[model samples]
Target: MADSFLRPAVSTMRSGIAGALIAVLALAAAPTIASAQTAAPATKPAAKPAPATKPAPAEPAKDAAAPEDPLPWIKICSKDADKKNVCLVAKELRSQEGQLVASVALRDIEGDSKKVLLIAVPPVVLIQPGMRVQIDKGKQLEAKYTICFPNACYAEMEIADQAIAEMKKGKALVVTSLNIQQKPMAFPFLLSTFKKAAEGEGIDPNAGQQNQEQLQQELQKRAEEAAKKLQGGDAAKPADAPATPAPAPAPAEAPKP
Candidate 1:
């Protein structure tokens, strides 16, 4: 009976010791698990995409057309008799009958900083009164008569930079002078192409010569036509028409007696 009782006590004590050891191991592992969970990194949120942009519109196509003709005004460059370089931007106005009415030119000579404005009009103008130049209702500038030839009378003045600037912006250039009868005569030259011609290149010397020849021919033709008209008018009168006789030495006989 004693052996059975002791064996039962030992068995119960051994079972209690094993259960305590297992509980202590679980308590130690619980702290390790908690530390590991706290040390782990957190996840980041994803970024949103940017909005799209619209494309720019294309430009319109340009139309193709033939080039326009050059303006009538011209620039001529040549050497003077002194071997110095000279240039002129010139334009001529003509009547319906192809007669030259007037000419306007800007002359530039080498070694000279200032430009000269030259005007040529028919010789029927008064020299003492001088001439006046106006641009688009602007101030009137006076030019003195420099010289005269059989065909044309020339007037010139040293043009300032300000006047040239005005000419470029003006619509018309009006040149006024006193006629033989002491009346004002105005000649207008269109300024629409003045700027272009003033800045453009000059023609060849040979071409300029040809132009001069053509102008001479035209003038000669006009003169011939005028002479023919006068001759025709004279011829229309009777060739046998008696000339007006002088008061036939009327008093000669009476004085002698």
Candidate 2:
């Protein structure tokens, strides 16, 4: 009786243990199914793009108004050399009637250091009497025409130290030139600040400005002085002035007549 009871009880216990093990396995499989149904699907990684390029900067806007030019009266320039400040002084001359007549440039000549005046006249003007520059009714500096270009006639003159001194110290300069008619036209170059212009390598255009009436007066005064000097030299014979030598008496004609 004891064996029969024990065998049935043990069989029932084994059945119960097998069902528990099956239940645990099913519970583990249920979680896997739930995860597969609810979880996000995997996909290939997106390709990285090439490095982006930078955009070019925008350009500045152009000005609307036309650009202004530098002063038209004069220009100063320097050349490259061992000496740092070797420069040229330049000026443009215009007529009272608003015509461009001439240009003048000055420089201290190398080696000798003499001042040189390079005068450029209009091509249409006469080259005779060459070109003359004087300071405040002072003695004239004359130079013969050396070249003629399509645009201008050029005369270069070495200025004496005395003349340069006078120019630097004087009030004005008178530039005389012959026109196409061979008439003398005097241009009074105002030298109000010439010293500053030469040393500083530039002229104050306003410093040299003169009115027409003032120019006319200066021209008249210069003309009168020039005329007086001419007349005085020709007519005013000093008492001790040597007389003109008389021509030799005609040779005595042979008595054949």
**Candidate 2 regions off by >4 Å?**
1-75, 80-85, 95-99, 109-111, 201-257
lDDT of 2 at 18: 26
- Candidate 1, lDDT over the whole model: 0.64
Give the top-scoring candidate (TM-score). 1
lDDT tens digits by residue: candidate 1, 121-183:
766689998999998789999999988766567798999988888888766788888878898
- Clash pairs detected, candidate 1: none
Could you tell me the TM-score of candidate 1? 0.54
Cα RMSD for candidates in order: 53.3, 54.3
Per-candidate Cα lDDT values, in order, are 0.64, 0.52
What value does the lDDT take at residue 208 in candidate 1?
A: 59
